[model samples]
Target: MTTFDKYPTVIVSENEKDVWEGSKHIVKQLKTVALDHNLIAIECYPGIDVKKLYHDVIQPLNADETIYAADLFYNNHTITEMIESNLTEDDVFGTFSPHSLEEFLDDKKVKAVKEKLKSNQKKNIIIYGMGASLFSNESLLIYVDIARWEIQQRLQRGMPNWRTNNQDEQISRKMKRSYFFEWPLADRLKKALLNQVDFWIDGNDIENLKLISKEKYLQGLSQVVSQPFRLVPFFAPGVWGGEWMREKFDLDKDEVNFAWSFNGVPAENSIHLQYGDCKIEIPANNVVFYYPTELLGNKVYGRFGREFPIRFNFLDTIKGQNLSLQVHPTTEYAHEEFGAHYTQDESYYILHAEEDAIVYLGLKENIENEEMIKELEEAEVGNKDFDDEKFINRMRIKKHDHYSIPGGTIHSQGKNSVVLEISSTPNIYTFKLWDWGRVDLDGKPRPIHLHHGLESIQWTRDENWVKEHLSSPNQLIAEGEGWYEEKTGLHELEFIETRRHWFSTIVYHETHDSVNVLNLVEGEEAIVESINGEFEPFVVHYAETFIIPEHIKEYSIRPHGPSEGKTIATIKAFVRV
Candidate 1:
């Protein structure tokens, strides 16, 4: 059995009341670990109000609480000023700062924390805040983790009224007030302390945990380096969200509708590690930081460093509105203009398509630049419908059709379709040229980037050209007793390759120093096994995404049920050499 299947991981409800009850359950686990230690410290990000949580755990035990704020140890003015000066639109991913958690952990503060443990006055202490564990022992370290989406949701739900004045200021203050800009620095600090973290607790919905001995924690990290793993998918609502994901995934019905399901966007997604009755939630990016070569392979690691280089997400526009017509910057333009390392060269792999489902791609033939610009500008401000058919090429799609979208290609996923957006990791650089004259759910005009989109658009990729080249074709590569493999898209700038496999019997494959991401597109379930015993075999469900690290060189796939004489289809993507 796999680690998760063998272990009895704690399951908690997302209900507000049950979540707190779950926290109390976590306190019970912590009590056991705290018995041997003189001091217990919890490390977490800023803006976490653990006052009641601390009281719940420590008050029950009658242990005296010693609180130390990481902010208090910071050069407040210097850091604040640094963020304000460097913060820009380009800081969408993150901004680097000379002021890091290491520097903030002043020698005096570290010494003070160390001296307190040495004394006999208070036998038990709780040091809680960002980077607190950096000053303590590994066994004594308890990490309380929170999701970035949760932080933003909480801020919007219950912020002081005065904090929401100016639009730009409100956005900036949210990052500044919560110290989100310090994430890159915080990640650096966490990288150094990951090996030392003994207990990891989730502070998002309910208090879930992965409490393991130091040896087990380290062993788990090593196993992660050579496994076919999957991260917990992240869900979010958008203006044009639909009900497909909500009903399909059995997600909470109270939240509006589901717009996106982040299946493997390491930059913003997280993974959960199960150890018996406990589980630890960590950022997927941390997986890369710890095992760069193993996870990304040699060539990918050399080119992108610790960045996971690729992203896979679901776009649910079924029964919803169309996405804004957008274009991504060229690689050179992205680096020169935004300090971004890569550009978004994406594709739309149609997962489900309803009758008349359309995808807006490229531009119509003989389209006049001046007229198109004038029409888009008018649509941006006034209540007028630009003749989309005269400019944009709307193509009807069916299930499993792949449309390649290199950089500078204008595109949008139309309504009544569920699209799997496979692309490079640079996700936020889309320049929206048009929005179909529709306002956002907030009743505000969505932001437009006419100037940027105009500059990024490739006029050469017109309707006819897109039909001939961008519409991907499948080519049979190999066949076995009960299986066949078809190579799909391979674009130069896209830097990723895709293929489809039809199999009933086992099909053996190897990563060959390149990481692979796969999903069962047309099957109930399948089993993925490592032939060389590099990692445990795992079951993948329909439309569920999973990763195979480069270290797991030899693997095989076999359908779960007896052969019904029907071939199951799977889609696989990997970084191109």
Candidate 2:
């Protein structure tokens, strides 16, 4: 049995001294803060239930007046008109919005709310909602934050987008609106207001809320970058799901199957901070937003700003089905169509595979692009079963095989294999060409994007080019006592580089002024320690992904506990210099 930890937490403190739990305790803290400040503004992320918040915290506090930021926003129709370009008619894809949160507000209603706040100066006033903090900076600012994964779950449960009534809307459409329109605007505002926030609330769990002071929150973030840590991994089921994770990770047996595990994608994962016995969960992206320089290094921060450019995730097809035939938009196409600065250049590192497992890669030699596109279009409409083997290259794969897939190169992972997908963070730009005539778990036909795929596919990258440039060959780079390192590529066209290390004793590593993500691919247990005693020793098990911040210049890893004195291996990914 694999001892894979699903909920990994960073130990910020040994005792719980500054954390508050439950609504009653949270309300008591707010009541005390309200005594000194005239306005207590509780700014919320979208998908938060502000009405339930009013009943639990504001109503119990007995404030003189409560102002909801939702009331001051323009009507739903007006908001739709303002963001129509961003929320395109497409069900899956939308352009990123350039507008700010203030653009969505009604100036007249905002002015009126300001007048009301001034008139009630003598009384205790509370303002709470999405844009509550826009009224004043001097108010006691409390930010209620929920992770993107949590918001996605709420969307699946029929939660409407902010200030929009779409409870009956398809989940994909709702997610598109949030991703392109609401989330970008909200994240910009959140980053701008992060330093000004006085308190932070973990609103992921409605019944049980966790509150931490700004001092404690910053302290936790600072402690995180100083050491090797793991984010809380989230699992989801898909139409082509698998049982590897369900059985190995001891997941819920009732779940149909686990298809994907977001292990190192900070944007979609949460970080758990342990203070004594209390554990508070916050979005992992908060670390990227606040400590971009410390966490991402000067060079990476200069290039990507606050975005965590690289992603590490799992795509499980073991005992399930093949993924859709897909191609990611090229750099120029992604920028022109989706407002993305970069495209998804990815690589698949096979973690586990059955004997007959295969991977569908670039097109076959001398295949006609027009003919392939015509067949795909016809197959999409249920006219005939698409002959995949005729045009696409199929390669037999086994454990530890790696394949590089740059944008515009078609690819798919066949059934009975578990793939560790490392790529750029622009994950939603995949233009799926075909789905083998399979419907989604909802029994609805999956959406196909043959038009975009045709425009983006690189016809030149056929079998010859794929075999020559995409298949990774292990090239030994360095060797020391009891250790040897090999370059286990991400192709030269990709910005990320990968290295595999096999060691029986200690292996030294430096960050090279860039953040590094690693997984123990061939080890039962290992320990990572700071070379200069900068941080404590961190233990990891097989198949667990962990991050080493850019500032940790020097560290060492070796087999530990039961695996000590035994050869073990790890695969590490970092930005290319």
Candidate 3:
């Protein structure tokens, strides 16, 4: 079993000061700040508990008057109609919305709230909740933030979305609504207000809140991108989940199985900042929002503004079942239907596999598209089973084998293998065509999107095409005394380039004006150091994902401690430019 550090943290500073812990200290700070500024605005993200925050902080301060920003929103019926186009009748998919937060608020109510705040100047007034910052520019603003992973957890635990009461809705539907509508609206406002906020609060943990000044928060983000760092990885159980992550990573044994380890997707992960001995958790996307040019070089930022284009994650099916038969939308289809700039072009690198492991990829030669669609439709309605062997090609897989899967290619990962999935940032556009007549862990049939899948499938990509372009040939590109680098397959059609390095001595690397993401695929431990000693040496273990920012021009890696004098390997991915 390998020892994986699940909760990795970055030490922002050695000095032990400037962190407020617990509700009492936070309330005290708010009260002191309210003495000078009467209009205190606490702007919150969607998943935050406004009631809990009011009870804990505002109630203690005993403000003479309070205004809730949520009260200014239009009625639930009008708001629903406004976003109905984005939230389609389908349960699993929705179009992305380009609306702002102000669109949801009632104009008359907002004007009334402004008047109330102005009239209560002598009464020590406070305004709190989502869109609270829009009331006044001079008010003392506190932005409350939470990670997307935390928001998903809350939704699973029966928490409702902001301005709507749908706590009993299905988890997948709620997530779709948030992804296509709620999150985009909130993120736009956050990006505009983050630079000028007075204070920032980490509300991931309700009982233990952390407060800090905006200067300290931005400084912590700056320290993070200057060197190599890891995000806090989170694990989730799925219907086809496996036992590999549970056994090897020392995850919870009580759970049925662990399927995914979201290691490098910044939007769904979080970063830890240690001030002295106190650690504060904040959304990882904040780094991308604040330092786009510094974190993702000029070239990458120009292509995808304020977004992390590359993603690294793990899909463990070892000793488990096969993944659903699925296909992703093409770039044009994704842009026209979902308002996404780019589609999900991905590749799978086999980390570990059993002897009988296999992967279903592409279609067999001389297959009819109408015949395959007919069988899938029949299987969807339980009329008959879809005979996958009659139409698809199944390729046996082994350790270190790489397979490139661009958008519109039909694919599925078979059982008894651990796959490192490297892909673009739009992670939720999968169109599952078939599910083998199986139900989810909740005893409900998983939604199938046969219509969407049929529209996106590339019928010309048959077995011959996959054999020529998708599978890795492991072509040797460069060699040194003790190290050699090989080009791994990510296909020319994909925007990400992948390279694997096998080394016993130090191997040098340069970002070349683009951010790089890497994994220590083979080795007990390795050490990464800056060529010019610009930052401290960072150590990584087997199967751990880490990032090197664009600012770090050059670096080197070698086996360390237990793996000294032994050969190790790393697989790295970056933008094609």
Candidate 4:
């Protein structure tokens, strides 16, 4: 059948099983759909309790056994058939990595299941799992979406703590494993299947699960494609978590504290597409893949393909402790060592700060390479504290201050500060040099990457050099009756650039060849609208990051309040020539 002919079929697919609604509700939904046709519901799940699902869902729904259960179909081949054993680090880190579901397509066991779905001669068949929806043609697809944070909360509440017995240990283990180790691969598989879906359900909303249609979904995408878009922020806890974001943002009080918010790192965050009165959430990377040029423009598409090259996130340490001293690899080193396409060149934009706020940046002026290395080595192996002031320079900062951090620079956020980190898109690959002789909540010494830090640190970034170059000196670039723009000299190293705008009236701007990453750092709220009446206007609030797509050639921003004459300050970043 042609692609256009396949739009009518509706396939309900979930990224992961809902914590509240198990197979019982899903199977009941399937059975209700099966009443008028010869229907079969295939449960294509592994690493799960299939027998429990059968007793709980199938037996209750299937009175005459007309709705056949294909649960054991995956047993045709072992799990080993889906992945290569004893993979080396180099092999795993290489480019051209395929998602886990992509590997299943080649296995003969999957082929057998596909043939069974075809040969059953049923007018309607429901295949439900990771890749189950991919087997059929002319079917509408449904994706059930959930955030990684919500999944952890559900797991902690119900599931057995397999990794640890200690509460702190379990939380730490869950954060580390869930975010970096396990979910990345699983998310890759989910993203691979997202484009094929016709509807999406917010799995977190068990009471009134919003079912979004493909037409409405795509229509929402089109509206936001060339306009300012923001993703649903995902939060996580840290040992140095503070009360600022937890109280100011009104987050879940159950969390230890809100430490980080994944604002616009597309690979690690998802966007919510508004559909009439409902909303659908999909991986932010899907938008880049679906419309690369529209989101990233022609120049970016030609250079980076579908990769969104910038990330905006928050690091809150107000009334908390200092972050670990860390360094990221240079672009050349990242490509050669980890096979990464880009390096993380970051900057700290202090959104709010207490009286004693200070940032650890670069090394002391007279420190030699050997002394620094020896200090790091001693700290890593013996949990010994370095003479922080003798080696590391602590620069005092206040709200609205910007600190540049190119790759290879040693830096960390200090206590009593809430920083908006603007950087390149590379998320992982930090080499922690020290954690200030402190142990994690589990009473274990946190990891210190001595070797990698030694290799990546650019020793030239001394105290004087840092003050001269990394310190942002804002300069006025343009001004009008009630609006003005200032160029914030963040860095020119990674093709990423930033500017600040203070405007009381509507100020016009254009995205010439790059997408715009923006936040209302010093205002209550603001509205973004197209200059030529093309796309609809959108509102952004304080400390919230939003994007203006490359397709939005011209747009304007105005302060959003009681229409008085209060100035609004916004920070905007983008790729530059």
Instruction: State TM-scores per candidate.
Output: 0.84, 0.99, 0.99, 0.80
lDDT against the true structure, per candidate, is 0.71, 0.91, 0.91, 0.67
Instruction: For candidate 2, write residues 1-577 as lDDT tens digits.
Output: 7689988999999977778999999998888877899888999999887778888877998888888889999999999998898888899999999999888888899888888887888888888989988985688999999999999999999889998899999998999998998889899999999899999998999888888999999999998888999999999999999999898889899998999999999999999999998889999999999999888899999988999988999999989999999999888999999999999999999999999999999999998878888899899889998899899999999999989999999999999999999898988988899999999999999999988999999999999999999997788999999999998888887889899999999999978778999999997999999999999999999889999999988899999998998999999988886
Model 1 lDDT tens row, 433-486: 888887776676777877778888898889998988788788798998999998
Top-lDDT structure, candidate number: 2
lDDT of model 1 at position 440? 76
- Candidate 4 stretches with Cα past 4 Å from truth are 1-108, 123-125, 137-141, 148-195, 204-210, 274-277
10 residues in a row with least lDDT, candidate 4: 1-10
Pairs that collide in candidate 3 are: none
Distance from true location, Cα of 124 in model 4, Å: 5.6
> What overall lDDT, based on C-alpha atoms, would model 3 receive against the true structure?
0.91
In TM-score terms, candidate 3 sits at 0.99
Q: After superposing candidate 1, which stretches have Cα over 4 Å from the reference?
A: 1-41, 46-48, 58-65, 73-78, 89-99, 102-126, 133-139, 159-180, 205-212, 562-564
Question: Model 4, range 72-134, lDDT digits (tens) per residue?
Answer: 223323332332221122211222223354443445656666666568755445554434445
Enumerate residue pairs that collide in model 2: none
Clashes of each: 2, 0, 0, 5
